[model samples]
Structure formats: structure tokens, C-alpha cells
Target chain A: MKSLLSVQSHVAHGYVGGRAATFPLQYLGWDVDNINTVNFSNHTGYGHFQGSAIPEPELIKLFQGLNQIGCSYDVVVLGYIPSAELIDVVASEVAALKKSNPSTRYVCDTVMGDQGHLYVNNSCVDAYRKLLSTKIADVITPNQFELELLYGKPIDSEKLLRDAIAYMHDTYGVDHVVISSLDASVLNLQELQLICCAVSSRFKERSQEQSQLQVFLVPEIKSYFTGVGDLFTALLADKLFTNNGNLVLAVNQVLTIMSNVLKLTHQLGIKEFTQHYGEDSCERLAEGRMNDGESMRFFELRIIQAREFYDYSGAGEFSAIEISN
Target chain B: MHRNLLSILSHVCHGYVGNRACVFPLQCCGWDVDTVHTTNYLNHPGHGTFQGEKNDGRTISTIIEGLKKLFDLREYYNVVLVGYCPSAEVMTAVYEELEPIYKTKDRKEGPVFVVDPVLGDNGRLYVPEEVVQVHIDFLKRGLVDLTTPNQFEMELLTDTKFLSWNDVKSACYKFYDTYKVPDFVILSVLIDEQMYSVGFSASTETVFYVPIQEIRCRFSGCGDIFTALLTNEFYSNGRVLSPQVLTLVVDKLHRILLTSFREERARLGRDPDVIHDINLVRLRDLFERSFGGDLEVKYL
Candidate 1:
């Protein structure tokens, strides 16, 4: 059995993101342990309320305790680090883990940016770049503005988004980069809006050639709940762990599950703002995309773009692995 | 002093089961629920065979007493009380009982009243005309701090058609002049007229006419979310908000709806799972987040 570890802001039964990310990992039958960075009373849906944050040292200690228990996760999904210190702690953890388990990879949900601006603390962007980008975070998921912040330029189109995604994948030495919530067509916002995109740079490492970039657009999902990014990373990590690390197939499987769940939400007439983040919502998703290890409908996603690579090495091989439970 | 907002509803859980059962997202922000009192008659606390069976005043009063005891006017300052659905009658009663206590004792901050007047939608009163009558009386007697009604509900209250932004403004002004409710929020409106103004009562006479930006699809509980957020914006800003500021809250809600639609499509028409995290009351923060969008606020 493969295990995955995810970190984000969890408010027990309160908010959607932490749990949204957490449950899907579990639903897919992966043993997932989540480390909450902050536990707000709930997802700041209520106007004013209170909660607490978990310190980085304590989080490190928690992982250490898990190690003592012989519980090593096959994948680690990191999201919304509340502080620069936590990012530092996570970077160190990723490095150490990768050393021991070369196959295990880190997926970073770069949640520091929102709408069209940066929302994370000013001190943390460099931490994300240096600590997360260089040494760890095999996969980095940043929305459009986040990509611009990382590249220090405006990403006006999908082409620009792809460029930024490729830049982070190569410069940071990460093979998988996903940019979400971007519009390819500015003139028509609706037609252009996409949920999320996965830009692949596997061949870039083998050749001096530019890495192959692929974009997987997540259907445009409202930022209603908190931990969706966390959930996406966890599912990808699990699929990769179970599948010899075939990032493409893994991305497809996870997307299928998310898309199916989103469709169910609409059928029920639930409001657009609050997408049921409760445990019950997971029950609706109670069933996972199954294919008897052959084929899954949700696994069939539209691949919007693919790039070619010739000479790329440190970037590693482009392989889609799927390890089934 | 700590303050809180309570969202009360009176409706057949089954009638709007989809709306009420999953309403927790609208009720609790910060995952905190002051109280949820469900009655049958969307606006009346204890009447009807509500939920289709009612006329039980004692059972309803007991619930009211329970709510009253849970929140003490003496302890909280600036507590805002909001009532929607068939529960408005009881909400009106709740306010009547609590208002004097809040005023005479001056112990806690005065409770702010925001009445959504859920009597109409899409320019027509959906509830029984009598139920709408109760709300009209509630507003006429001057019982709320702010009132928000869609074009239809506003017209039902004041009997006017919003032919243009100017017309909407005149009707709103007439309601205010006639009824004395200062802050009247027209929930969602679209116009082809000149997009002349931008945001807030930048100044009262300069009333801004923010040409509404249209985001498609209407899911349930929009009115509930709107009132909750608007009340927060109005009250938190010392009850004096720039019309443009409301755009931020409205925009977030619009996005949430769109996102939910995306999730729904992914799930084959299923509701988005994020609905679980929604508390009707905290919708304000959801819409007010730094990244949130704003309503195109404007006035005549």
C-alpha cells in the first residue's frame, strides 16, 4: 500500500480546502496523513472568527514521530505554507526524504498568489523559490498571477503561462508544473477560463532542447473551499507512487475524480459559492473512478498542449507511472 | 466586547431541503453557528402546518426563548440579527423583544437589523402575499438598520418598476423617504442604460450607479448570501459603506457560483463539494477576501 502526506490549513470539519484535499486522497484508497499549517475556526467564510497555526518545529517533530512509527509516506503534497519558517522546514524535509527515497517526489501548491496579485507574506516568495523550487518540490502548482510573480512578468496568455510553467520546471529542477485559473482568451473571459494546467518538462532535462510542456486545464473551479490544491497534489502523488511515477496518467486520474465530483455538486443545486466541503460531500464522491486496472473514463482527459524535448538531463525522464492499490 | 451575527430561517426543510439541509455553508462563517431555528412558514416563526403542519405557538416560543437565552444583549456589542424565509414573522418578534433591551440597558451594543424581505424574486413575490404583508409592516414600522430587496421585492414594498437606474434610484429614494430606512441595497440588477457611475454612495447625492457585471447561472440561497455579506459590509464600516465596496463582496459570490458550476459540471451536474465549507453567514468574508471581486456600484 502506498501512502501520501499532505500539508495545508485545516479547520477540523470547518473549512473546505484542507478537507477537500484530504478526503479525495483517502477516497482513492490511499493512506494519507495531513499536517495542518493553520486551523482556523473555519474557512474564513464567517466574517470574523479565530483559530490557531501549527508551528514549523512542531510539524517537523510530528513527521519525526511518524518515522519512528515506521510510517513513511510515498508522496508529500505541500500547500499554503503559513510562514516562511514552515517553508524552510518543509524544504529540509523534502530534501531528506528524497535522499532516502529517490522515487518519492514533492508537489508544491504555490498558493501565495490570488486573482491577479500576490497574497502571501512578502518574505515567503523567495523562500518558495530558493527552498521549494531549487532543492525540492518536484511539482509546483501556481495560478496565473503566481507564475508572473515567480517570473517577474505579466502572463497575458496561455502561451505565457506555458513559458512560466516551463521556466519553473527547469530552473527549479522540478519536472511537473501546473498553472491554474488562467484565461487563454482575454477578449472572451468565459471561453478562455480554465480550471488548472499541468506543464510537463520531462524531455528538457535530457536535452539542451526545451523541455516538453503540457497543459492540463482544470475546469474553472471557484475558490469556494480551501484545500482543493492540496487534494489535487495528494491524488497526483498517490497515483505517481502507485504507478511508477507516470505523471500524465496520474494527472488524468485525479482530474477525473475532481470533475465527476464537481458535476455531482451542480446536479444537487448547491450554491455556487460553497461547494459542500463537508465529509458528506466526500460520500457523494464515495465512489472512485475504477477500471479494473485497465481503463477509466475520468482518466480520459483532453490534452491541450504538448512540447518536444531532445537534450535534457537533470530534468529527468518523462514517464507516466500508475501504481494501483 | 465580542459580537456575532445570527441567521434564522423558517421553511420546510424538505421544501427547500436542498437549500436548508446544505445551508450550513451560509449559516456559519468561521464554522461558528450562533443558532439555526427552522420553522415551516418561511417567515413566520411558529405557524402553519409549517413544514406543512403548524399553528404551534408554544413549541415555537420555546425555541425563541432558547435563542434569547443563548445570546444575551447585555454581553455583546453590535450584534446583528438577520431573518429570512418563512421565519421573518418570528424574526420580527425576536427583534421586537430584543430591541428595547439593547436600547434601554445600553449594556451591549445595539443590535443591527438587516431584513432581506425574501418576499419576492425576479420581480415577483414568491411567498404568500400575506407573508409579504408582514414584511412590509416590519419595514414600515422602521424595524431594520438596512434592507435589501431585489428589484421585484423593492417594487412589491414600494410599488414601483425600475425602468432605468434613475427609476431604480427614485424608487429606492421613495422607499427611504417614505419608510426612513437609510441603507437599502438592491441585491442584483442588470441594465443596458449608460454605465454612468462607479461604486458606493461616494457621496449621497452623487449616488453611484455601478453598471452590473453579469455572471450567469442562478443557484439557490443567493439572496441569503447577499444579505449576510451586505449586512457585514454595512455594519462593519460603521453602517456607512462606499457603494463600490459592495462590489468586492458581490464579485466573490459571483465567482463562487461560477466555480461551483465548474465543479458541478465536472461531477455531471452534482453540487460542488466545497458547499460543505460554506456558512451562510460568512459569505461576506468569502466575497470580501483580498482577491474578491466587487459589485459595479453606482447611483443616479
Candidate 2:
């Protein structure tokens, strides 16, 4: 069986970070070792949370202790590192892991900021860039804003996005780059879809005019949810490890599971909204200004409640568009 | 009311034990489980050595207090499961901290506190003797509605040496009669080659004995798993009908243990990395058994 070392934040009340990702990977038959960075009462999107962050020295001690115990993993997934110092420590550890076992896969979720806002410290961007410069990570999943943050420019168009991917490949030597979300205006499509693009460092030589990007599109669910990215990164990394770097198949597998989860989440959220307020209160709430807290309470990813969807292997009607640019 | 549960136990990062062994099974049973970690470690200490700190009374009480402030403990959970209180300080803190909340709750609608007094196994105590004393004192206070202890813990609690079924039954009755705990289960009563568990419900004024074939395997967290299964089954079955609940829980645990052994054998066959004599599962199949409910049980 494969083993995964998941370094992320933990919440006692709700699912996010390690709490969100660990179960699905375990259900997929991987032995999971979870290192919690913060033991919070709940996720922070609720606007009220209480807990303490694990200090950097303690984190180092824990990792070193694992090493002393001869605990090695096939994959090390990094998510929600709370401090730049801890990020540095993680990078060094990942490098050491790769040096010891060249077959070990390193996946960096690059969880800095998303949707035109930076939720973590601005120093995290530098930390991520420094980690990427190590060239030890095999897979990096970053949203559009995070992609632009890495390249230090706005990827406002298809041309710029492709340039950024190529730059990451050329400069950082990372193999697979996954943009988990893209602005709909880039494609000029109606009925907005949550599209993810998977690009490989080994691009086709005949694709000077044809894009080598595999685009996976799923219909968007209109509710605020957290931990979607964490779940996506986990599934993507598991698929990549199992399939031996087949980006297309990995992306399709993740999308199938995610789409089902989101659809169920949205339905449950609407049901909760109607239950709490009245029949059609979800419509009333949807027709007005969106409240993130209220919407999130109704949504909350439904990760634990709708856990059966994690085993979905079919992509359904969703298929990848192999763009040639 | 909703089937919500609050579990206070140990959380291990690597292997399943304590809440790691308890929480997932309850969740799979469709209960909303909220957990407070008494301590967090890399793996069970039975693995030779482990890392992480013992979450002290202050830290634990703070987390529980935080939960109360946010969710109003009495309103949020219908079942409170306690296990492995590592220290007398922590045990006292847990009781004093939650006493007010339970007191405020309407008794008819309040949470049912089920204590698994985890002191020691195999004729010894793992934690300090004061921890055992604290547990006895807590039970003496009649705060817990249910308590599950193995033979050694039961012996320690009642301070009795039982050589037969009648002695063990009298010890259980004496415990309930003294502590006023409405329900008590003595997990593992050994007679000759067979092992039996005694479940007694004072409310129904009944007792039941469940015996299983003694499989020679050493695995951590069986006690924790059995406690979780008992808590959920008792709660869902309306806390009465002790015989039926105990039978179901024991049968499920036996089946899961068999599955774990089979899985371990299969794992050793495929993976050359695993050395023999290591418990491959170490309580890893809570989720696997969550969806498993088809085990046929013929109660003897």
C-alpha cells in the first residue's frame, strides 16, 4: 500500500486542510500520516475560531522524530503552512526525502491566496517561491491568482496563462502544473463553468499553434465552500502516483469526484437553507446580496456528510478538451 | 434530538487508538461526532516509542470551554464519551469543567456520559494509581450513566477477586448498587479458554453475558473500539435492552478483528517492507467496518 504524509491545518469541528483530505486518501487505501499545523476549534470562514498554532520548533521536532522512527512516505503533500519558517523547514525536509528516495513524489498545493484576495500572510508567497526554487516538487496545484502571484504578473489572457505555465516549467523544473480555476472570460463561454487546466512540462512539439493543455470543465455550484482545493489536491496527487504521471487521467478522476461532491453539497445547502428559514428561502438568499458566513454554514463542503461520493471514479459527461495553442 | 456525540480521548497521528479508533466508526454510524483530544501522539506507545505532547488539563478544559461557548454543550450533543484520562489533574479538570454544563441541561434531555475507565490491562495499570482513584471517585459521584472496564479495571474498581461467573456478577451488581451507574459492562471475563463480557442495565434490571473464541492476537485500541460501539449501540437502542446491544457490539467487533487479521496477512504477503510480528492494522479498519453490517450473529 502507498503512504502519504499530509502536512496541513486541522480543525476539530469541521473539515478543512488535513481534516478534509485525510479520509478520502485513506478510503482510497493509502496509509496516512497527518501532521497538524494548527488545531483550531473550527474552520476560520465561520468568523470565529479558537486554537493555537503548532510552533515551528515543535513542528521540526515532530518531523525529526518521525525520521528517527524510520517513518518514510511515498508522497509528501504540503498544504496551509502557517509560517514562512515552517515552509522553509518543510522544503528542507522534502528535499531530504527526495534525496533519500528518488522515487518519492512531492506535491505542493501552493495554498497562498485565491479569488483576487490574499488570506494568509504576504510572506507566504515568498515562502512558496523559495520552496518551488528547490525543484523537488513533482506536482504543483495553484489557482489563477496564485499562478499570477508566482509569475509576478497578471495572467489576464490565454496567452499570458500559457506563458506562465511555460515559465514555471522552464524556471522551476516542475513537471505537472494544475491551474485549479480559470476566469471564464478567457474562454468567452456562457453558463460559467469551474474549469481546471492541466499542463505538462513535456509539451507536444507540434503544438506551436495547438495548445497541449487538458481542460476539465464542470458546472459551477453557487454556494460558498471551503476545503474544495484541499480535496482536489489530495485526489490529484493520489491519481498521479497511481497512474504514473498521466496528467489527463488524473485530472479527469479528480473532476469526477469533485463535481459529484459539489453538486451534493449544493443540494444539501439548499435543503438546509429551506429548513432553517422557509421553503424557497434559498432562492430569496440567492436573489440578494451574498453572505459568506450564512452561505458557508449552509454549504461547508458536506465532506463528511456526503463522504460516499469520494469513491466515484466515473467522469460522467465531463471530458477534457485538449487545446492545442 | 439529533444523534450528536462528543468524544474526549487520545488522538494519534499515525495509528488508530483512542479517539482515532472511536470517532470514525461513530461517524460512519451517522452520528455527528465532536472530539476533544486528551493527548496527541505520532503512534500508539505500544509501537515502542512515539512523539507529541500530553494536552494538559488547562489546554483540554480550554478547548471544551470553547466548544461550550460556541455550541452550548448541552444543546449540541446527546452523548458524551470519555476515555483514557491520562492524569488525575486532567480527569478532575474534565469533570469540573463540564459539570456546570451538564447541571444546566434539562436532565431528561441532557447528554449521557459514558466513561471507559482505561487504567491498565493484563493485571497491571498503565497510568498512575491516582488516575484510577480519580476514576473511582468520579464513578462514586454517580456522574456517568455507563462505564465499560476490562476485567482488571473492574477488579480494581470494586476491589474484588472473582474466580467465577457469580463473583463477577456480584462485583458488577455491587458496583452499580454503590456508584448508581445505571449501566456497566465488564469487558473480557476469562474462564478456562473462553472469554466473556458481562453487560448489566440497572434500569431494566437485567444482565447478559457474551462469550467469544479467544483469538491469540495482541492489538491496541480494541477496548476503545468496543467502547465506541457500545456507546452508539446503547444510545440508538434507547439505552435499554442491554442484552441485544451487547450482543450486536461484540459480534461486530469480532468480525472486524477477524477482518483485520486477514488484511494484515494479505498486506504482509504483498509488501516486503513489513516485518513479521508487527500488528499491521493497529486499529486501522474503523471505516472499513462502518459500511459492514452483514455479519451473522448466533448468540449463545
Candidate 3:
């Protein structure tokens, strides 16, 4: 069965490994495994809260138990985590998990620092660095800042981007890397952002000049809601697994999915503010629940990114462009 | 608590929009999709009463300010606000100042704002790019109680392009996962994405195949009217159910828009590039009759 293991936690109910990460994967038909490392009453962003964290060994035990089940996982998604201890344990567990089920694809949502700042300690960040520097994960998604922090330098020019990708693959054993919320060329970069993505895996033919990078440009979407990374990574994993581990198809699909959501939020004029709106009642709340009653076809997806999925080898092999824009 | 109904509407007579929504909602709960000539686009800027250019899209801030001024909104408790067309922004703005007055603060029902995504008709974005983000930001903040985004809008929100049930479910649930806004709705189900083979008008016996990209039927502004009526039926009627009932309402709106499309073709004479009915709708059929209650299952 497909499962998602969210490592992060916060006191906020709306964000984090809570409803934000767990429910979507569950609704996506996966037998979601929610392994929250830190469980506060709410997200940490809303200030201090009283809660404890799950130690690395304790957390590893659960995944190890799953390994004992002998059923290979189709996909494994990792989100925010607590201490460096958890990260170290996670890296080892992930490595072992991959060794056992080599076919199992792991997607790491490297949520080091959020929209504003990093929520964890230096030890935790270092753990992510080490975890990422190994072959434990097949895919890594980090926002611009997270990429910078991981690389120990700002990701400004294209050289840095290419170098970063090479570094990730060579040093960390990362197969695929996606850096999000980039203002790469735009002057008002913060408002209008993009995602610089690269894919390199044993599953595909590799090329020296493939660059393995493409920019996922999206209109400006604003907000302070935590766990958007959880949502993005969850959808990405769902798409990746559903598409059967074709990284290009999966990443391309993720871009379209979130872009569509952003477009809808814009078209409908959904404002960025926290308050109960519309005809809110306990009755109305039920309509949003995840059930067959709530299921429906989402939208007409136009595959605009098919041409930009960069997977190639230097075998001098003639290849028809995957798609034409 | 004088329960007043607030509706934000615009875009009255485009080939994609219509004028019957007021009647439909008026028939059910006496609320309307408020109207004006402009999409608030294409007008010279700087006029407070009505300042945007025609195609530029009226600022949500402008529309919200207009709503506050028009309603003199400070006097009410437990207001049911249903917004459509260019009014999604208006619904969001009101939420900031409106929620505290009611919402158990005074043991009253505060302003309940429902936003109907009005980005496209027949599946296309009619507004500017910035507007899409503004709307998403609003929904992300939990300002929208009930959101009626079409199938296309759902893809836009979740960033999925070619989606089946799994992708669609992932996209829909992402709203809850990220923003924690519990009220997200996908309006209709097209029997086929190609729209080429599926879209039909049986009454007129018109079997015009929709182009692959342009498969959706041309309905002017039914979205604005649908969201308005559904929100009113939800908040104004004081219904106490779970989020389950919204799918029923969303399904009904889809069919209502279909029926509205046929009606528009009849009214506007199938103008190929455009249709007649946008704002006008038949609300009772959706909420009161509940679209035969079990009808939405056929598509699922």
C-alpha cells in the first residue's frame, strides 16, 4: 500500500503534519502513515506550545516495523522533523528502507526554513544536510532559502543552480531536486515566484548538458499558512507514485496541479485572511469532508510542461522532443 | 441580529455571462447577484464610485470598499454574504471587519462569506493573472466559508493538469492540508475532458462538438449566481449539516449551469463565440429540489 510519513509537527491544527499533510494523502487512497516527530497543540509559528517530540529510535521503530511487514512500499513521503537525532535516525531508516525495497521511491520535502525563517535548530538542519547528502532519498523538494542553507551559499545565478544540482547528486546521493519559491529573474521576485527543478536518477538516461533544470513559473500567491509544503509534497508524491515513478511526469503534474489551485484561488478572489466565511455552520463544514460525497473531477489539465521535462543521456542518441509547446 | 444578505456581483451581459441569477436566487431566498456594466475592467482609474478599466479586472480592494460603502455594513450581526463574479475579493475584505461582530463574540452569527470562483466561463480565466493569486490567498487564509471552484479551478488550485480521481482528490484535499480552509468545492463534472464529444444541447438538438480545449459550454456568468444562491441557501436558511451537503449543492450548480446554458442558447441564439445567460439562474432546482439528490452520482 502507498503511504506518507510526515516527519514535521507543530501546535497548529490547520497546518503541519496534522490535517494539512495527512488528510490529502489519505484521500488520495493511500494508507497514509502519519509519523509526526513533534506533536504540539498547534503549529510553532503561533508561538510557544507545550508538546514533546518522538525520538529517532522510536520513530525508526515504526518504519522498521513496516519493513518487517515484507510488503514493499510503492511510495514514501517525508515532511518536517524535529531534532538532529530524528534526522540521523530518519536517514539511516530511509537508507535501510531503500536497500530493502529498492523500487520504493522516497520524496523528501526539505522544509528547513519556511516562508520567513527556519523552525528547527542547527542540529536539525545539519541532519537534513547529512540525510540529503546521501542516497537515502530519490527526490528532494526545497524552497529557495532551504536550498541556499543546504548549499551553504545563496542560489542566485544559473552556475550556482547547476553546481548545486551536481553537488546534491554527487555528494548527497539525491536523485531529483526541486527548489521552490524562487524569484530568479523577476524584479519583484518575492511576489511573482518560480520553481527551479532538476531530475537525475538511475531510472533514466543521463546527459551532461541536460542541465536537469526547468523553471516552474507561477503567478504571485500570498499567505502565512503553515504546511503548504506538506500539501505540495503530498500532491507531488501522490502524483509521482500514481504515475509509477516517472519523475518528469510526476513533477510536471505537480506544477499543473498547484498552478490550477492558485489560478482558482485567484479567479474566485479567495482572500488571504483567517476567519470563518460564507454560510458557515456546523452543517456547511461537513461539505468539505473527504468522502465519496465530496469527490469530483478537478479540472481540464493542459500539459504545458511536457517539453521541459529534462531527462536525457549523452549517448548521442537521437530523441524526439517529449512534447512540443 | 438583523440577518441581511450581502451579494457581490458584476459582469452582466457578456457572451459568457447572463442575467437570470437574480431571479433564481430571488425565487429561493430573495438574494441577488448584484450587477454592473464593467467586469470593472476597461475603465479609467481614479473614480471611487466605479473606477477600473474594462479588461484590467476591478481591484478586489476596490470592490470590497464598494461593498462596505453600499451596505453601510457596520450595523448588522450574522450577515450571510454570497459573492460572485468580480466580487470574490469583496467577500474577503468584509471578513476582516465583519467576523468579530458576530461569530460568538456577541453570541450572534457573524458575516458568513462564501466565494464562488469566477475565473472562467466554459473553462478559461477571464481575469488577469494577479487576480487568481489574490483569490487563492483569500481562500488560503480561511476567509472563504464555502468555495465553488469548477473542475478547472480545482486543478488550478492543486497545480494538477492531467488528473484522474486520485489527482483530483489530492488537489481538493490540498486546500485543507495547506490553508486549513475547510470549504472547498468543485462545481461540475464533464462527462469527458475533451468536451468535444460530450457537451450537448438536447432541447435544441444541437450536437455541436466542443473543441478539445474549448469543450465547455458557453455560459456567461452562472458561477456568480450559483455561489450566491448556494451560500444564501446555506447561511441564510440556517442549515446545520456537515460539509457533505456542499457536494450536492455543487452538483446542482453544475447542472443548473448546463440548464442555464441551454436557456442561454435559446435566449441568445447560439452565438458560437458567446452565449447569453451569465448571472441569471434557476436556484430552487439546485437547493430546494436538490437536483434530484442522487443525480450527482451519475458523473462520479
Judging by TM-score against the true structure, name the best candidate: 2
lDDT of 1: 0.52
Worst 10 residues of 3 chain B by lDDT: B41-50
Please tell me the interface RMSD, in Å, for model 3.
Answer: 24.2
Tell me which of candidates 1 and 3 scores higher on TM-score: 3
The sequence of per-residue lDDT tens digits that candidate 3 reaches over residues B1-300 is 113444434321111222224323432442322222223221111111222223112333343333443233434313344344444344345444444433443222345555565565445776556557767775665444556667677667667653454454455456556554444445454434532111111122221221222325544454555555456556644532123344445455566666656665677676334443332322233434544433222111
Residue-wise C-alpha lDDT for candidate 3, range A44-141, written one tens digit per residue: 44333334565555566655655554435667777777777888888898888888877777888776785447777877777888887776777788
Ranking by DockQ: 2, 3, 1
Candidate 2, residue A72: lDDT? 82
Off by over 4 Å in 1: A157-159, A186-198, A203-209, A216-219, A223-226, A242-244, A269-325, B1-300
Evaluate fnat for each of the predicted models and list the values in order: 0.00, 0.30, 0.00
lDDT of 1 at B32: 25
TM-score of chain B of 2: 0.88
Q: Regarding lDDT, does 1 or 3 come out ahead? A: 1
Please write out the lDDT profile of model 2 over residues A1-325, one tens digit for every residue: 6888899997766668987887678667677787888777777777667777777777777777777777788998999988788888888877777777787788888888887898888998898899999887778899889999999898767778788888777667677889888775665544445655545544323334333666766666443678889999998888888777788777877888887888887787678778877886766766753444455556667666666776665543567776666
A162-279: candidate 1 lDDT, tens digit per residue: 5665677567777666554456452123544454454464533463656555545555764443345555565566666565656666666666655554454433323321243453
* Candidate-wise lDDT, in order: 0.52, 0.75, 0.48
